[model samples]
Target: MFEQIIAGIEGRIGGPARKVVVDRGVKPDNARHELGRHNPKVVIPLGREGIEMVAAGNPDVPVIAGAILHPSPSTARFHTTVTLNTDPLLLFGRLKSVAPATKRIIVIHDPNKSEGVIRAANDAAGQLGLDLTVIKVRDRRSAAWMYEAVFSSIDGSKDVVWLPTDTTTVDDTVILPLILEQSWKRSFPVISSTPSHMERGVLLALYPDYSKIGNALGSIAIDAVGGGARNGAVFSRQVQAAVNERTARHLGLKLSDDLRRQFDAVFPALAPLSR
Candidate 1:
């Protein structure tokens, strides 16, 4: 999907001739060989670390946009939306600190393949002394109905919407608009695993640094292609928490001074600029 988008943009710019090379996963040594086979002038790998590795090998090869896979290890590994058990616990802790009075937290679990996320959310809620309302969406493929049910369940109730790291929910067509609508109607805030959600309009995001992942990958790619000569290199990973100030303001939520300072990016509300 990203490759297609980049290709379209390149078509307009009359950029270098391009062809895509995809892999099942980002294993540093394996990716280097794959790119070597293609031997394209430029290789743009999705995920921060992948991009960095590629850049490390072929420093001269131009790398454009980078994809952020997982925001953090606790939340979920990037690309795969399945959340680890530790993710929900971290999320619950964050919620407890922010809205200690919160009693019922609504979680939408994908019925098809997210039993783990559901169980983890419930467990996290228990740890935080909160009641968990687990709503399982029967049709995991259709995000519209899943979101509709989530909003319907929380209507006229006091609850925070917890978004699990499920790929079925993260595609551009589904979760993004649902989040925007819920925020507009009820001032409800969303706690999510991906920082991209924060940029899109979610109230807060507690996840890893996606850009860092891309940068890491880029460096590795350069080295594998014999580019990073000056510096000794190794695989790198970094994690951090982030939030969107604009989304918080839109929902009339105030972020703690300490949190605001710690986040990687803070987007303001999009009301004035939308027009």
Candidate 2:
């Protein structure tokens, strides 16, 4: 991913002045060498640890980061970041394309850890004329308990549950099976974060295609700051929606040829959906 991003960045600014570095997080000697070795135009750290190590080692360098899922609270001023997390706007657009009548989106989260994401989802839902239903699991409980509370209100015809990136409240092995089981019975769809979710019976899974993310990050950096970039998280618009044909089939959805075209990738091309 980083390599693709570097290739993209270099495309804009013609030079042999970039590298797709393997991040050595917080290793003092290596960090020093890597951070100090380059007085190049921009330093783009691929992940969170790389971003951190770069900031710690040399705050003066302009750093553009990629593949970090969540933006840090105290991000440095000279560092600009692009994340692998799907943008809410893009998610809404794709959801609209593939399943237009999805009237409600249910989100389960540990509210304390996910206020921002929940708020963004709510905004996205409102804009698309959908209700954003939130199920706050203040504490972790059994998967069955969580499912019962969540499924009690799901309207099979109009409701869809959105699985956020939060793992504390809903781990895949525990919560996904229960959610898929309930949704299967009701015949509603579920949207989630990773592409794997599509194979696991989730109707739609939205994620970043790393190469695409790299392209966007480089483009944003180029447009925003040519030679000198500053800190602030850039919302990456590069997103991929994976569809589960089996789940769609069960719901009686003939995902349109046009709608199918919206997906950047689909999972289980030939494998059966998990129970």
Candidate 3:
């Protein structure tokens, strides 16, 4: 990922002739070696540790990050922070494509963690003419109960459950199995931001396009210092979709070969023929 990011940075800065400093939360002495006399115009970090490392070095230097989790107070340090969470609007739009009859988008999330996501989802629902049913839960216990209630009311023919990137509201070990079980029994579709969920019977997943995300980060970083990029969170528009073909078959979807071709991945990939 960082290699793609470096390639992206080099692309924007007139190719490989220009060097972008790379650091992995190294000690101060090594930091000097990595950053010494570079006087970098921008810094792109990986995680919280990287963010802190770069920010501590020069708070004013523009920092662009990708693949980080929900913003905490600490994230304010970055001039631009791109989250790993897929954009709700984009996700909803894909949901519309895969399940055109879906009328309601159901989600259980922590209000504090998913404020922006819900806000965008509401707009997307309105534009797509789908009902957005959002339930806020403060913790895992409440989230579990809420999931049961919400799953019970789900109209399989017209409702799609959304599993966002929120760990508090969607723990893999506990909540994922419950949702999958409900989905199987009820015959409803489930969509997630996490791609690996497709292997576990999720109908679809929309995840980052690493190259495009890296390029976008480099673009934003360049604009931050030179063209004045906005200082806030934005979702990665460059995305790829994966589908569970078995799940689609279960839902009775008759997607054409062209539509199937569009997907970046398909679950239960065919095994090679023996020689």
lDDT of 2 by residue, 126-217 (tens): 88888887777766574347668778876877888887777766677766777777788878888887777776788887777666676666
Give all candidates' CA lDDT scores. Answer: 0.55, 0.70, 0.77
Tell me the TM-score of model 2.
Answer: 0.84
Worst 10 residues of 1 by lDDT: 74-83
Clash totals, every prediction:
40, 1, 0
Give the candidate order by descending lDDT: 3, 2, 1
lDDT of 2 at 75: 54
Decide which is better by lDDT, 2 or 3: 3
Candidates 1 and 2: which is better by lDDT?
Answer: 2
Better of 1 and 3 by lDDT: 3
lDDT of 3 by residue, 78-122 (tens): 787887778788888877777889999899999887887788889
User: What TM-score would every model get versus the actual structure?
Assistant: 0.54, 0.84, 0.85
Answer with 1 or 2, whichever has the higher TM-score: 2
Model 1, stretches more than 4 Å misplaced?
1-86, 138-143, 153-157, 209-238, 271-275
